[model samples]
Target: MSEEPLEQLDAVDFAVIAFHVDGEWDVDELTLDHLLDAPTLVAAMRRLPGEDSVALVAVDEDWFLVARVVEGRVRMLLSDATAAEDWDLAASVLDLLGLPEPEDDDDQVPAGDLGLLADLGMGAEDLGALIADLDLYPEEILSEVAEEIGFGDDFDDVVGLAPADHA
Candidate 1:
């Protein structure tokens, strides 16, 4: 949304998305490029807080399984992180803002992962398999998933991961 709709959004609407189910975080673990993608996601993920957190399983370097808990039901927020270039993220935002959906784009979400997969709570292996099916890699998926869920400042070691700026 062009403006923050904190009032319009309920705590349930505020999904605490995690990069992994194992439970970890990184300070400044997010980037601006990723922030641009959240609006659309926020729109589709309207249910809000269940386990108080969700996860993003990276199927590849670019794809992710953004799973969240809502009223005991799970919701998936899958996406091709690369599609932000063409306005998929922004469109999702507009949709959430109650704005009109943009004409046509390459950012359409597929059938299966569009909503929660099952009613029964899954075990670690099941969750892990879901992540594996989504193609999650610990380090890489962790980073990508972190960005997708808005965990920009949870990690303090971010600068250490990048080169120091030279004068």
Candidate 2:
């Protein structure tokens, strides 16, 4: 199968959510100008006024970033090991995680700490395996991941992804 550059997906496909499961989940449609680096993203998430705030970001069908902040501490995971070289948001994620760009262009590995949310249901390996499933679009995969973590319908609604399509 031929692949389109992930940069193209950033147009309408990139989105981020700052959520507190019991409270609110705010969505942001990411554009090239607002592709904030990790620290900035986390700081914004911090202002969400919840003890259990998490930032979930998906860039097309190629990458996902999950960041959680608790008691002033931050934990995060940036998936799609290969997107760092192709997507600006992914590269910014690498900077936030303090990881270097990939030396090779295979784009098939999990770049940052995958185990970051292992206890929350979707671990690194699970995410890696999900990404390998080329049959699913980013919305479908994100829907599954969100459901695993207890926000299936909310995420789909916020992202405007029809349940019928993913089903």
Candidate 3:
């Protein structure tokens, strides 16, 4: 695959901001100027009003990113580590995690904290399994993730997706 720099937020398929507060989960679309910039995405999540805030981003239908900010600390996960070879967002995510950029020979695997959402409900094993399923698309993987984390309906509503779409 050829490297294609993501120049703007418009290149992203969807960006959703989800938060848990007052024993309820809230979801909204994240509209930012730099959605693919890891630092910018994290900062935006931090500015949201919630005890726990997360940003779910799908880029070009090629990969998905999950960024969760809690008390100013950020944890991130990229669905396909090898996407760094072609995507600036994935490359930035590798930088944020202090990981080396994937080489061409590297396997297309997930990078960063698979356990990022463990406290919320999904464990590392489950997340790894989901990402391992190459038959699923980025959006489908993220949709399952949202469902596992108790924000399925909210996520679908905000992203204008229906469960049947994944079917």
For TM-score, the strongest prediction is 3
83-152, model 1: which lDDT tens digit per residue? 3233444334344434444344554433224324233334334434434555543334344334434453
Give the clashing pairs for model 2. Answer: 81-111
Q: Model 3 segments beyond 4 Å from truth?
A: 1-8, 164-167
lDDT (Cα atoms) of all candidates against the true structure: 0.37, 0.65, 0.83
Tell me the lDDT of candidate 2.
0.65
Q: What tens digits encode model 3's per-residue C-alpha lDDT throughout 1-167?
A: 22334354556899998888887888989875547479978878877787699889998887899999987788999988888877777888999999997776368888899999998888999999988888987888888889888898888888888873432
TM per candidate comes to 0.28, 0.75, 0.89
Select the stronger candidate by TM-score from 1 and 2. 2
Ranking by TM-score: 3, 2, 1
- Per residue, candidate 2 scores C-alpha lDDT tens digits across 34-88 of 3446776777767766576656677665567777776677787666656777666
Native-referenced Cα lDDT, model 1: 0.37
lDDT of 1 at 115: 29
